[model samples]
Target: MSVPALNRAPDAVTTRVTAPGSRRRPDIEGLRAVAALLIAVYHIWFGTVSGGVDVFLLLTGFLITGSLVRAMERDGRVDLAAFWTKLVKRLFPAGAVVLGAVLLMAYAYFPRSQWTTVIDDVWAAALYYGNWHLALGSVDYMAENSAASPVQHFWSLAVQGQFYLLWPLLVCGAALLAVRLGRSARRGAAVAVGTVFAVSFGYSLWITATAPVWAYFDTGARLWELALGGLLALFVHRVDLPGWARTVAGWAGLAALVLCGLVIGDSLPYPGYASLWPTLAALLIILAGAGTAANGRLSANRLLGARPLTWLGGHAYTLFLWHWPVLVLHLELTGLERPTPGGGLLVLGVSFAAALATSWMVDGGVSRATRRLRTPAWSLAAGVLFVVPVLVAGSLWAQSIERDRQLRTELSSNPLAYPGAAVHLDQDLARNLPSLPVYPDTTTVARDTIDQTRACNALIDQTEVVTCEFGDPRSDYTIALVGSSHVRHWFQALETLADQHGWRLVTMTKNACQFSSGEQRYRGEVFTECAQWNDGVMAALDELEPDTVFTLASLTSVRSGPEEHVPEGFVERWRQLDARGIDVVAVRDTPRFSFRVPDCTDRNHRSECSEPASHSMAERAPYLELDDVPANTRFLDMTGYLCQDDVCHGVIGNQLVYYDTNHFSYSFSQSLAAVMEPYLLEAAGRAPEAELTLAEAALSPEEAAEAAREHDGSS
Candidate 1:
């Protein structure tokens, strides 16, 4: 959303003046309206980049910088205090109202599991750092599937607010320097702003190429768009384009703006050279209005300054704030990933009504009431007084959720009460159900499956193999755990066996990087790091000469439905390890869900929170064929423990089964240690050949018959 940079002084001249080099341009207001509408439509229905935000950034630079320069020219000094006072009074009221509304809705409608995230987003948006928060989230693989925050649109507003705070200081400094040098203030400011544009644009191109996700929200990468507007402000007045030339340029720019969304999808890296299209288009439209009559022949201004468009433009800031949250809430409530046509229309209608009312009641009303507070200190105090409580409340809400989550984890740590998956299969299903208040509450689930706290898992971007050892380091029997997070999550189960058997356990894992010879893709980029890390892992394994290697056998292809198979490259790695006399134990991958399991269980009963085993399982026929692998290689399937009777429940044996959609909860994995120990020992050729103990022996025929009769009668 763009900050409305139109002059807001009650006594200022109407923005419709057509005088030569006039301060007001009605076309800019219409451009703001157009940009706001484009962004709303793209977000709600098209799901593409409209380049509307770039248009807003350019407009913000042109309008705000132009106003400051004119003030310096007329008064011989910029009124920084008055400028900030007016800006704050104009912007903060509407933003604060929206933030408060979003917080209320989050508490009332969203699941408590998401409360901490919502509160943190609110805090970030309120303090104008929401963009950075989102930028960090984009890079974190763990946060990849998180639902979009309702206030995510606030990132653009944060960028604008940051610029509002910094741009004026730069302009004032440049003006002062110009006065000392006997040069025009506007020219000196242009030179300074131009340098910022050039440097920032260069950085934007490089960063967008290397790290597009971060570049999308980075202020430094975005500064060039605003700087382009500032440069236009400085020079537009000096341009003497002929009427024909202005008309041609205006239409060309308008055509480009209208087609931007269709031509440039969100899949393309943004704010790089691609951003120049919209910013340059906006500049053309603004320049075309310089000398045109309101209804002149071939005039872009006449078309842009129409009554309906200007009305929408006047309320653009409020529209930008209200539309996104409404759209997000609509999707959540209706359970539609994309809006239906009827729902889309309803969202737009509601957003328009809200924007219209808020623009008048909060934005316009606050500005008028606060106009009497002429001193900057008084204005600052009023703004702080209005905003600080909301910020504090948001921060406190996040802290409170964290505290409650920590308390739950502490209270639920009873080993006897929560023996996890360690209990006998029959006893677990019959008596040792999941505990109350669930282990790994929503606030902790994201981190609950992680073994990196012990420094066993490699960082996502690192190619070097980092090993963390557990159990007896000097043990002759060595078992190396290798591959991606899927392999690492199993370490919690294996650690117990390693200790009991006096085996040295070595873990080498990289985030989401499987040990396959095939190419890997992470966040849509070719993952060269995975390939490099695999090379290091092979060398390390060769040197260590581990007796056994444990890793994932198959991965389910989400896009291909229930299909699962070993990647060709995985077979290559397995053969290499087999040649080195390292026996391989490949465990079947766990069933994955489309939604977060803890969240599902929190919202629904255990019986209601299950998926069909048939759908969740990879096509098993291929895995069964792996029986013909090298003599040293063995495959294990433990799906029966995770799923029963063609259905897989999210919670098993009174314990949460997964920390997220796929990874096992640490406690649940620990529980599985008992079930896994025998297989691991067998794989290592160390299973004891002793007669079974009474408790461990299979039931005799008469006893089994009696148990079956009892179960039938109970059912």
Candidate 2:
């Protein structure tokens, strides 16, 4: 599920009870405060910043593992039954409170369709399986521009819960092995800590280098951070250092911690070397806090030891529990990416206030109530009371699955009815297209490449890649349009007019086709799919010797100001194509939608679906020239076909021209054939309208085969 290292160390040990009046570790509490604040800021402002969570993981692994190991030494043996019960008691109450509230908020804020996904997540969360679900789905948690699941944040919580389950067992086993070997308790603990740290860190570094995405979210890759913490605890008593050195270390550590949250933005691979800054800082603070009173002056400073911060620090566990759910629910209710600055402060204030109330009320009440639950009946009741509401809320959310599917079907049939909704564009064309137009058989010339005219049927099924041939193969004219969904959208119209003229349209486009010259960011890492696909397309184009290559204007053009640079790779690739004697036609992008495609049809009146939005053609003006290239490359502004007046309507001329957000419908494409016929003739330098006989117009593929069969029968 969570990468194994990121998961709980799957070991169990009894909870440890520290002696009364143990020397106060003010710095550790301060560290906790810092970790909590980093998480809050990152969640509120730069939710993209995940290093904060890494720091938290290090601290959690260190603290809990340390406690469990210490308890194992004192108790002589680790009690698995007591260990699990205590873990449940500590973890489940706070988790249940947060998840229960999140489920309620999801129901209140989300539409029926949105709630189904949320419900599915809630059920996963209840069972501590969120990491498995999210990883399998390849969900991008940092995508603020997209819709979110209410329980999305719970993936981290699930990881921690899994860690708790395993760390204790590992500790117990290590302690037992050491006792058997006649080793001192401290020596045994040290060996256990060192062994785990070495193995886990080695694994983490490799995972961080090789599979950074999995390393980021998976528990296995991250266990080293926790192992580091556990190891630190074993040596806490043995480390002998000067007071000045400890003070210096404490201050330096705090400074390093602050810099990590501030300096580490979204650019770096997280939970890797980037995480070392905060983790090492956390280690320093923990070490500094444990030294004698001489070194404790700064480590146990009056400011850090102050009532309010330490009080929040005391309730940090509870605060972490309540804060995220509250903020998530608040955001859901408002539909804001995150709370505004003022709103963030309000969320912080309200969350802490709620945390305090829950800490005093539910957390304290549950702890007290469960103390009497030593008997099976009372224990069962306590467990059921805690778990049933979460289960039921989760189950209710689950039932919306069928409801969501049915709604999606109805919405796809009529997009105008659902506002702020998105329907699968490929499915729409497959379900709706009535029939294909018939044309006279073109002569089969020895063509090495596909023709554009015959690419119509090929474009319909988008999931699979297909090859087609269009014009007389021997002709010198061949044009290839290569791109992502953006290029595919224009194919229907291009194919229609291609058949009318003799130009072959060689189709080679893929979803998310980034014609990159070098490394590029995609799906949270440097990806090469687009680059590899581009290489293939370029090779095919060179071999075919296409007369012209059509490419989309930069996606950056859609959002950037007129002066903004087009994506460098796109421009460079086109230039490369131009150098090969291919005329480059840079087609400006079509109007993109502000809302989901189905928002136009969503029955809910809360969404904006009435009119499509438009931007200036000036946005595309910069890269249109391509005159610097060797071959003659032209800029075509076909925005006019999709736009009207000042605005681009999703529907054009009373026709649902766009089946979804920006993609033109095939029906719309068929109509545009008339308007584009002139351009096609001009581009190919040929004009030959196909003259279809009545028999040819009416003849089906089956009938043609039948006619051949009849002639054969007569013969």
Candidate 3:
């Protein structure tokens, strides 16, 4: 629920008495109750979009805009300070209480690794920019699999809060312009709002098509819904439809609102043309009920004005605020992806109980205090009282993050502290290793893999091939590290070889984008950027005429099931590169896990976190096809370093293996430099020199002897 709209309803009841032609519509309150219930039910049980949020957005625009216009029409000017003060008093207290509770719950129940995200979200929601934060997160693949934050629902509230702040200023400007131009203030306001609606709607359509994931939480994409509501508010007072027309419109709109969720699944792109169904339906219901008597007739208002709904509506804001966090926390605690019917009902019951207590105790107290205080200064003070605690908590969390960074920096400086995957290869060294919390710690694990020195990985949205040169830049033997981050992570091992073998190493990479010749799908959208980037990469490769192009040969498809296959595009790209006399060295992609390895290892034992290596490597056979393609093509599998006989470990040799779910931790990958050097040399047709083997390179004779002694004792 939009806190301002729901919280202001009681004030509107008193204020409406002085305004002409204004009567309290219990039906709108009832509708709010229905919207809130639908949102809660869909989120907790169905795990789908219910169009309830769109209804709230529409109601927010309609009610707030209507109230502002009525004030302007009666007083001829808007008292912006008084308006803002009232809003702060109405909204802040309940929001602040919820934020404080959520923060405490998070710190107590959530993993330390997730504390930063929760704190960041707390700050964003407090500042009314949570929508942008969520929008950015939606496009990030790494964050896509993260457990839903308890405050994720606050994105809508943030949107509403922003609209609340900006709409009054807009209405005030329109009112002034109308006086200067000798025009109707309401009409001028309608025109201005309509213009904004058009521009926002156009942008929404474009963005939804191009980047629907981001569009889902974008404030710009959502403004049209709010503007539509404002337009209805401006005109509803002037319209006087007959009872029969109202009956038809009311029933149809009610039906549309009820079926919208079932008909338009949550998976579908929304707030574009798809949103018109719900927003327009809501507008119809509001317009149809206007000026209608609430007698026991067949009118929509009469049906909606039932006492129960209005009671729920009275507590809608609190219910909306409390339900999401309750649901998310419940799921996190229970380890259930979704609750059963009984569990969902229990969750809803608890949420409603909490909402009632907060609504009466917290919101009721704030409302009463605001009435007694009345002054802007007291309201400002009340706002500060609400906001200060959350800011203080956020500051403490930020400091903790800085401290973790410092610890990680200190630990990282000692090479012996994190020998990474090398410990698995040398059992002696493994036996002699000191105890340490997995290097890269949960705070830094997300970025533990891949090179940081090079700005060569193009973002998911970019179509350019970012290139960076490493290792023997002037050498005659050129080996281009090309593909997505999977290939980029191998640069640690390959860079070691390049330095040892005198080869020029060039990196061509894009984030989550594989070097495919055909179109690919990313986050359910056509990866036009990836395809375009590949074209650029191919052209660059031709120009550079690199001796060998190292990229991913095969990947496991998570879309359909756990089937491994050589992507048609990868095969096609390989053939093209081979035709250009570029040796295609395809490194088999690593095993991907269903859960985050670092988080799993942090919470559970290594045995509990391990998965069947065979199941993960079921797709390994597809890489064998690379042998049939051409003489220039070479296939390399490094799974031996990553997995054991039957199981794959989250931690190897006292170092965290995977950073997230699939990507290797940088330290782990660096540990594999010795193991991977021989294969890399053979792939590039270079023989190993008189340098030590992987074990010999990393372990001295004394340390090796001590490790052997420990291993013998353990045996």
Q: Is candidate 2 or candidate 3 better by TM-score?
A: 3
Residue-wise C-alpha lDDT for candidate 3, range 66-133, written one tens digit per residue? 77777777778766776776677667777878898989898787766567778888899888899999
lDDT of each: 0.75, 0.56, 0.76
Estimate the TM-score of every prediction.
0.89, 0.68, 0.91
- Candidate 2's clash total is 41
Native-to-model Cα distance after best TM-score fit, residue 298 in candidate 3, in Å:
2.9
- Candidate 2, residues 219-256, lDDT tens digits: the string is 76677787787777676766656787677777887777
Candidate 3, residue 378: how far the Cα is off, in Å: 1.6
TM-score-best of 1 and 3:
3
Best candidate, TM-score: 3
Off by over 4 Å in 3: 1-21, 292-296, 447-455, 471-477, 495-504, 523-526, 558-562, 619-621, 625-627, 685-687, 695-715
N/CA/C clash count, model 1: 7
Whose TM-score is higher: candidate 1's or candidate 2's? 1
